[model samples]
Target: FMTLLIGSILLPVLVLVGDIVFMFVVVSAALGAVVMTIYGGFETGIEFCHRITMAVPETYWEMIFPSSFEEKSTNWILN
Candidate 1:
């Protein structure tokens, strides 16, 4: 009974913690991108942000439904 009670409480707490951590990571990544574009003299902050946002979200999406993804210069679309 105690174990079941603990599990019920712990599961939601763990999920909340995981969500908070993911949010922190996303915010940090955005801030880092802004700083990188500012100090690194990228054409625009949004451009740097765009590149990162493009690759990262796609990678996460692919993790679940990975099919045929190619990379770099060798991509068939590039050829």
Candidate 2:
């Protein structure tokens, strides 16, 4: 009879603790996935920008930003 009474009380507590642990693990996994996704996007953007800048010639930059060259803008598309 005493063991039955003890088990009844302890069983609920154990179940509640297990639920809390499960929730914590689920939330942690979700946050980790979000962070990894954002990191991946940033890495991709940086790589794309690096490629574009490296591939474009200096003349192209001067044409786009004439102020850097201390020259008047002749690009009609911008003007």
Best by lDDT: 1
**What clash pairs does model 1 have?**
none
lDDT of 1 by residue, 6-77 (tens): 789988899999999989979987897879787877776767676666555356566456565543322222
- The deviation in Å at residue 7 for candidate 1 is 5.0
Model 1 spans with C-alpha error above 4 angstroms: 44-47, 54-61, 71-79
Question: Tens-digit lDDT track for model 2 on 38-77?
Answer: 7778675555445444433468676666654435523333
- TM-score, prediction 2: 0.45
Model 2, position 67: C-alpha lDDT score? 59
